[model samples]
Target: MLMKAALMETLLEKFYKNHQILHKESFMLNQQNMKIFTQSWRPYSTLQLKGLVAMVRYNSESSWLFELTSVAIAKAGFLVCAIDLQGHGYSDGLAGHIPNIEPIVSDCIQFFDSIKVDHPKLPAFIYGESLGGAIAILVCLKQKREWNGLILNGLMWEISAKFKPTWPLEKLLPVAAFLAPIWKIVISKPLASKSYKEWKRKLVVKNPNRKAPGKPPMATALELLRVSEYVRRHCHELEVTMLMVHGEDDVVCVYRSARFVYESAASEDKILKFSKYVASVDW
Candidate 1:
């Protein structure tokens, strides 16, 4: 019994030491800082996809925003920065008043110019979620030669154009977007992922004092759909290769949209990849 007790005590000591090492490693990893260029700009106004927005991104980092989709970019082999488009984050602007698809593309171009990197020919990768994907596609269309790669998550292209007929919605879009109204188009229903819910809940839990703003402007839907249709017809114009990924269980944005992008985009070097949220990738 005495020998057995001594062995148990030794095992406990080893376990405690291992736990402490893990704790320290985690703290260091979390503390790691990726250089970010945070700026606010008023992109030239157009018909839709308008307003001044804040851009919080990392340009000095070696790799681009490829490794992580959610959260402030993780330090990866690729330099990373996640942009919160205008009228969305800390930037100034009314929620409504998106002019048209052209402005959306222009904003991204403006962002690239504002960054002013030495290498105009380096492999710059961008990741956009939902509406961001739509803009990402548009940006690539304009400057295909300049960028080397693209990444998108839950792209917003799947939303039907037949949705909210343009003539009717366009007339009211300014009003609704001004109101920042919410419209239930393609809700996740019972199929919603628990992980997203947990993530959302934790975010809210962590910041209980702050309430997330209402749905984006109704004009957003109008501008997004218009952009989607435009991209569909002009997919042949996109020249940059894109690496695509979408969730199998994503209900808000369907999986077929990624397929459409792969099949339709003019990019010859494009590759399609599938991944789940919160999963780790070695590359």
Candidate 2:
């Protein structure tokens, strides 16, 4: 029994040591003056590396939740990296607020371009979750023919009308967005309960730092609505190799939007996958 215990202890020690050697790091990336929080995990191998994957997280969430997924991808022979966008997680700005997504897209392009210089030979892929998936598509559209591939998990191609603001409020959003952009209006129900399955929903609730309130700021809400429309109009412009996987019954992002993007994109190598239960990949 003592010998078996010792063996287990040795295995645990090696596991942690290997994890340490995987070259994981968290640092602040300066996009102009905005300090974007970023994290990365590199495979602990001397062999030729596969590629680099840049992760864009779902909205209203931080990079912390995506850390485990990044590590897993790194272990799969790719250098995996993720960032907390300006308004979310440890980054600067108000919680869950972005008046414009173009700046956010610019920040990603700058960060990824800087890193790619250090890794010139390897192909780079963009992986996005929920709202991040929309951001990834826009990024690819901005820099056409640059990315090798795109992987979207439960992407927000079209937000369900159930999440939309009510009649009078929807009509007032234009002026409200301009006058009081920071006002947190209840547009939809709480996403945590709808986003995950039962057991995983409990885990999300237990995350102390998670910004559970799904309320969107006046301007931010307006921007998301506009962004969704813009993505739909230009979906046919997406020409990169792509794989989009979605849950059949996702209430947060919906399933039909995923199907629309898969069918609309110009990419010949695109694929759309459906699963029994789907939610954010950051978990």
Candidate 3:
């Protein structure tokens, strides 16, 4: 029995060794001198490296499931790296507060550029989900002709009517934001509940780094609306190879808005895919 157990342990170790990936985590200070959490994954197999992929997570999401996605990409022969935006994950800032997106965009650019310095010859791709999609677009715009490809999953081109503030509240948002930047505003439903399937929702909420599901801060909500409009105005300038995937049933970020951007974008090689019954993070 002892011999059999030893053999089983040895076989398990061999299996893991064959499939192992190099995963690392670290902290970097952004321009604002805030500590930002960063992670990277590289496959240990003998396969030739294909390219580099930089991932950006949506608002309120950290490195939880995002790390799983990164590992999968790494296993496919690409070096995958991701960063936690300020105010989210293990980063240092006011929790869930993003008053201005430009700084965050700058942070991503700085980190990605640092990584690219080590692999200047490899094709680089930027992948963003939800709000991160908007950030990714901004990043590409800032560094025009730098990235090889851009992938947006459930991009938040426009906040869904089902999710945004209602009539009077929408009109008064600016005033509220000005008066109380940190005050949380009421929304229709918790984003996690609407964005994930049952099992996935449970896993998402279980994340210790995840901010509690509720209304976003008044300032953050206002800034997001403005950011959406900004992206709409600039999307036509996008020339990188692009792939956009959105769920037809997503109520947090409108699918129609993604279609509009897909049509407007100047990328000669762009594909837009619509899934039947997917949600925000389901892709």
The per-model lDDT (C-alpha) reads 0.46, 0.78, 0.82
Candidate 3 TM-score to native: 0.89
Model 1 over residues 1-283: C-alpha lDDT tens digits?
A: 7897687557645643543211101000111131222332211222232112212221111112221232132212222333333343333234333445564455456555543363333346666565567667777777767666666666666553333344555566657655654442221123223325465545434431233323334555556656767877886787776777777665555567778878877788887776665321110
TM-score, ranked from best to worst: 3, 2, 1
User: Candidate 3's residue-wise lDDT over 135-177, tens digit each?
Assistant: 8999999999999999998887687776666789988999999
**Who wins the lDDT comparison?**
3
Ranking by lDDT: 3, 2, 1
Show where candidate 3 strays beyond 4 Å: 1-19, 281-283
Task: Output the worst ten-in-a-row residue range by lDDT, candidate 2.
Answer: 58-67
Clashes of 3: 0
Best-matching candidate per TM-score: 3
RMSD of each: 14.0, 5.6, 5.4
